[model samples]
Target chain A: MPKQERAEETRRRILEAAQETFASQGYQATSVAEICQRAGVTKGAFFYHFPTKHALFLALLEDWLSQLDQYLNPDRYLGNNVAQSLYAMADLLKAGLTQGRDYLPMFLEFWLQAARDPVVWQATIEPYRRYRAFFANLYLQGMNEGSLCTADPSLAAVAMVSLALGLLLQGLMDHESVNWEEAAPAAFRWVLSLMAPDPATTP
Target chain B: MPKQERAEETRRRILEAAQETFASQGYQATSVAEICQRAGVTKGAFFYHFPTKHALFLALLEDWLSQLDQYLNPDRYLGNNVAQSLYAMADLLKAGLTQGRDYLPMFLEFWLQAARDPVVWQATIEPYRRYRAFFANLYLQGMNEGSLCTADPSLAAVAMVSLALGLLLQGLMDHESVNWEEAAPAAFRWVLSLMAPDPATTP
Candidate 1:
């Protein structure tokens, strides 16, 4: 392979190895030496691509947020009715989580790290607030377009985020207990039901 | 102090010291030596009451759950209507969290530990499942008692747990983003309103 192509390959390998180790052993326990060994690259090659382990962590964090940026981009979902749009987003998250169940532990790792490190806390929390805004904005848009009923859009967004967080946390802790696969879609439907303009459906 | 009373006092002091240190430094970072120093007790005294650091943690865990056992107790709320009962429960949790906001970090510690260790995982998850059952049972009772509308009680319970978990998790991380004090009661009331027999309120 060419020098440029080989460099890209090495970078990808390092990132992939870091992801696996961090998820299994947690970030604090994981070391550059271990990541290098798993990636089958020399320590010098690792340092060349990523100067430090912390630098590698930030890159991984950025990659996560970029993948999630789609949730904020509503251009595709905007055309659909709000309820439909929400179901689509729910389905997307559910599918991603189902495929990456082991990766769920990695989230607990970040959450614990953010709890301790101020800098990491800020980096992790900034995107979280953006997601909150994204959901709140969608609720407002839904209300404006006559697809939803009256309610505090921000509060509604809190409920949505809480539902997702709570379900994911419980699911991570006890695999068999939280049926998030069924619960996530059901929850959205229930929340949408409450938001229906007509209240005649409550029996 | 009497011998029995002095021993009880020592245990309580040790527990308090452990809670504070664990909250500030986290479980892995905290040491038995540090806990003894904070409690102003010798390691010999500490071991006399609790054989190991792990044993001290288990005592704390048990203490935590016994306090929460009231949420599962229906006799206190059994006299009131279903909506009233739900509000009381929400208030109970909200009040506890508000007062113990600092202690919230300890929760993250346990959650991280449970994710890593199977033994700790079982101890943590068993009570969680019981809480799930308690919520689901109340939902079912409400429907039968003519206070709640039709819905899957188990699913509703999942929503409740998720909302609480999600809100608390966010509040612990960002501190500013989640208004759980207001949101928790509002979310519960909203859920109850959906369960109300009247359908004229949504508009």
Candidate 2:
């Protein structure tokens, strides 16, 4: 492989190694030396790609947010009726939950870091605001299409995100007690029912 | 004061000091030395009351949970209709948010610790399960009282708790962005509306 290709490959390996190490040993316990050993990369290579462990964590956050944005792209579900689009988004989230189960602890660690560290907080809030706005826009579009009830889109958006966040936290804390796969969809449907226009007047 | 009373006073002082320290500095960073300094107690005295930092944290958790239980005691709002009971609980929660604003970080730290530590996890899950069961029982009672809609009470309980948990997380992350004081109650009202019996046919 050429130099540029090899550099990209090394970066990928470091990230995968970091994720594995963080998942198993946790963020506080995992060390750069261990990550380098796992990645089979030199310490110089690790430092070249990321200045610090926290920087690497921020990169992971960015990657996760981008992936979420792709999954929740309103454009992908826009052509469908508003209710259908909302359900599609719900389905996507459920899939993400199942796929990301192994990484949940890492995500919690990210949240904890965001709560404690100013640098992480700054990195987190922007994407969080974007997601909130994205959901609000979806609510507004649903209302405009007359498929959803007339409610303040911003408040509706907050409610939607809150339910999602709450379910994720509960699932993390009590994975065995609740069937999140089933519970998540049910909760989403309940929210949708609240948002849906009254059926009696539809005919 | 009597000897036993003086001992209780010292324990209370240590807990208060610990809460303050954890709120300001977070769990991992705060040390027993700092806690003792804040409490104005000797290290020996601190050890006398709690065996370890983790034990002290567990004590804090127990205290918070009991306080929450007292605040959310169903009997306080009993004899009123189910919808009224729920709204009352929401009011209580909102009051809690306002009163506990300064302690939110401490609560988040506790949650993070629970996620990472097995001892903390055991302490957390039991109280969590109790709260879930408590909410589920409330739902069952509402249905029996003919004030709530017909639905699976367990699922409804989960949904309610998820919304509350979501709101709390959001409040911690973006306190300035959202008026949790208002948003919390509004969300609760929306959930209550969903659970309430159909007014059109109530006569």
Candidate 3:
């Protein structure tokens, strides 16, 4: 492999190892040495790729957030009927948010890091706010298109995201409480019905 | 304080101090010495009350779960109407789940501990299952009483609890997203309406 290509590959391997270690052992317990060992790379390689362990973790966070954003394509499949779009969005979330072995701790670790560290927290909050607005805009688009019931879209978005997070957490912390995939469809239906424009008011 | 009262007060103090330290510094970072320092008790006194830091954490977890049970008393103020009972429960949860300085870390720490340790995980899981049944029973009562719309109470209860948990997590992570107290009442209304029995079907 070319020198540049080989370097990039090494960096990717280190990141994957770090993500896994951090997810399994948690942010506090996982270390650069361990991540380097797992990646089959030396400490020098780890330092060459990332300045600090926190920087590498930030890289992991960005990648995960990007993956999450890709799944929530409101513009692509949501369409003008906001209520239907909302239901569709929930279905998409249910499919996307399966609690894989490595995902939950990594995700929760982000929250824990954000809680304690100002720099990390500031970086974390922007994407979170963007996520909230993304949902809000979907609701607003539905209302403007005359497909949704006239209620507070922002507030509804808040409720929607809150409910999704809660479900994800239950799946994470306690796996057997509910079949998230089955329940997601039912939940989406309920929320959509709440947002749908009244037949009496519709032309 | 009397001799017995003084000892009880010291135990409470140690538990509270441990909880605060663990929540803020995390489980791995915190030490029994720090807890003793915070509690204004000696190491001997700390050891006298609890054998180990892990044991104290377990005790704290027990208290947290029991406190939740007390908080979710459906029969506290509201009577036999299942809808009233549920709303009351939801309202209590909203009012009680404060993150402030001490709670958020402690909450996340428990989760992290549960993830890493099987013993801790098993200890925490039992009460969590009880929450599911507690909610399911409320819905079953509501349905049988004819005050609620007829539906499968078990699934509905699971959904409702999921929503509540999701909201609680959001509140813990992002306090500014929604005025939870106001939103909580609306959530209760939404669930009750969705599950309420049709008047025509009532016996």
Candidate 4:
């Protein structure tokens, strides 16, 4: 590999190792030395790629947000009915979660860190606003197409996002008790029922 | 003051100081020494009430949960219709949160600690299960009484709880952007609409 390509590979390895370490042992308990050891890189090399542990965490946050953005891209579901598109989005999240069960703990760690640290707070809040805006636009589109009920698009957006977050948190806490795969779609349908126009009241 | 009265006061002082210190400085960074100083007590007095910092955290968790229990006591809403009961519950939570805005950060800290620490996790999960069961029974009652739509009560319970959790999280993340007091009841109505029978469809 060329020198730049080798550096990129080293950075990727460090991030992977950081995710694993943070997931298993958590952020506060995990140390730089351990992360370097897991990445199979020397301390100097790890420093070269990321200035601090906090910076590494920020990078991970950015990576997760971008992946979510791609998953929820409106362009990919352009032809489907609004309800179908929403279900597809739910299914996509469920599938992504099943594949990345290890990521749950790390994600919680990010939330906890963001709650306490101002720098992390700024990094998290901007992406969160963007997500809210993305869903609001989607809700407006669904209403304009006449497939969904007329409601405040912003509040509808908040409801959808909240349901998703709640399910994720509950799954993390009680995976043994609930079948999240089945529950996700069921919950999505319940929310969609609220967003559907009333047939009986239609003139 | 009597010795017994003096002792109780000291314990309360320690807890109040711990709540303040943890809220401002966070769990990992705050120490027993600081808690003792803020409480205006010596180290001996601090350890006399609580054996360890972890024990103090557990006490705080218990305190918050008990307060929630008091707020959510179903007896408070007896004779109200199911929709009314549900809205009352949402109002109760919103009121509790509005009063305890200072506790939000500490609550997140508790969750993070529970995720990482085995002792905390064991303590947290049992109470969480109890809350879920409590909501599940409420949904069953609402459905059986004909005030709610005939759907799977357990799923309804999950949706309600998830919405509340998500709102609490959003409130924590962006309190300036959202009026949680108004949003809570509005979101509750949205979820309740899903559980309510359609007047137009009913004969």
| lDDT (C-alpha) at residue A10 in model 1 | 97
Model 3 in CAPRI terms: which quality? acceptable
True contacts kept of each: 0.64, 0.58, 0.43, 0.48
TM-score, every prediction: 0.87, 0.89, 0.87, 0.89
DockQ of each: 0.58, 0.54, 0.47, 0.51
Tens-digit per-residue lDDT, B1-203, candidate 4? 99999999999999999999887766777899999999999999999999999999999989988987887788887655665677666676577557666777787777767767988877766765677788889878887787777468778777777777777777667777667778766776777777774333356
Return the candidate ranking by TM-score, descending: 4, 2, 3, 1
Which residue pairs of candidate 3 clash? A166-B166, B23-B106, B148-B196, B148-B197, B149-B196, B149-B197
User: Native-vs-model 2 lDDT?
Assistant: 0.78
What is candidate 4's lDDT per residue for A1-203, written digit by digit as tens? 99999999999999999998887776777899999999999999999989999899999988987877787786676655675576556676476547546666777777677778988887777766777788888778788887777468888777777777777777776667678778865776677667763333345
CA error at residue A115 for candidate 2, angstroms: 2.5
Report how closely model 1 matches the true complex, as a DockQ value.
0.58
Docking class of 2: medium
Model 4 pairs in collision: none
The C-alpha stretches of model 4 lying farther than 4 A from their native spots are A23-31, A77-79, A197-203, B197-203
Q: Please state the error at residue B48 of candidate 1 in Å.
A: 2.8
The second chain of candidate 4 has a TM-score of 0.90
RMSD per prediction, one decimal? 3.6, 3.4, 4.2, 3.6
- Using DockQ as the measure, name the better of candidate 1 and candidate 4: 1
